[model samples]
Target: MAYVISDDCIACGTCIDECPVGAISEGDKYSINPDMCTECGTCADVCPSEAIHQG
Candidate 1:
C-alpha cells in the first residue's frame, strides 16, 4: 500500500528527501502519489509529525 500524508503534516521537507521513489511532493501539505510510491515507509520514518500513514 502507498502512504498518504494527512493534514497533520507540518509541511516539513523530510519526507521528500527520504522517499526513495521520489513520490512525495510539496504542496499545501506534502502528498504521496500512490502510483509512484514504493511503500518503503521511508517518508513516514522521517516525518516529524507522524503525518504519513498507510493508505
Candidate 2:
C-alpha cells in the first residue's frame, strides 16, 4: 500500500522534497498522491508532525 498524509500534517513542505517519486504536493495540509507514491517511507521519516503513514 501507499503512504498517506494525515490531517496532522503541519504543511511544512518537508515531505515534498523528501519523496524520491515526487508524490507529495503542497496544500493547506500537504497531500500525497498514492499513484505516485513508492511507499519508501522517506516522507514519513522526515515529517516532524508524523502525519504520513502506511495505507
Candidate 3:
C-alpha cells in the first residue's frame, strides 16, 4: 500500500524532498498521491510530525 499523510501533517515540506517518486504535494496538510507513491517510506522517515504512514 501507498503511504498516506495524516491530518497531523504540519505542512513543513520536509517529506516532499524525501519522496523519491515525487508523490508528495504541498497543501494545507500536504498530500501523497497513491498512484505515484512507491511505498518507500522515505517521507515517513523525514516527517517531523510523524504524519506519513502506510495506508
Candidate 4:
C-alpha cells in the first residue's frame, strides 16, 4: 500500500522532505503520488501531525 495524506495535513511540508522517492508534493492538503511511493513509511515518520497513512 502507498501512503495517503489525510486532511489533517497542515501542508507544513514536513513529510515532503522525508519521502525518499520524492512522491510527496504540495497540494491543498499535500499529496502522495502512489506510483512513486515505495510504501517506506518515511513520510509518516516525519509528519508532525501524523497525517500520512498507508492506503
Best by TM-score: 3
Give candidate 1's whole-model lDDT.
0.89
If scored against the real structure, what TM-score would every candidate get? 0.94, 0.95, 0.96, 0.93
Candidates in order: C-alpha RMSD to true structure: 0.6, 0.6, 0.5, 0.7
- Model 1: runs farther than 4 Å from truth? none
RMSD of 3: 0.5
Clashing pairs in 1: none
At residue 30, candidate 1 shows an lDDT of 89
Positional deviation of residue 49's Cα in model 4 after best superposition, in angstroms: 0.7
Indicate the residue-level lDDT of 48 in model 2: 94
Query: What TM-score would you give candidate 4 relative to the actual structure?
Result: 0.93
Give model 2 RMSD, 1 decimal: 0.6
Q: Answer with 2 or 4, whichever has the higher TM-score.
A: 2
Give the lDDT of residue 15 in candidate 4. Answer: 82
Q: Residue 17 lDDT in model 2?
A: 82
Residue-pair clash count for candidate 3 = 0
State the lDDT of candidate 3 residue by residue for 1-55, as single tens digits: 9999999999999988877889988999899899999888999988889988999
Model 4 segments beyond 4 Å from truth? none
Q: What is the lDDT for 28 in model 4? A: 82
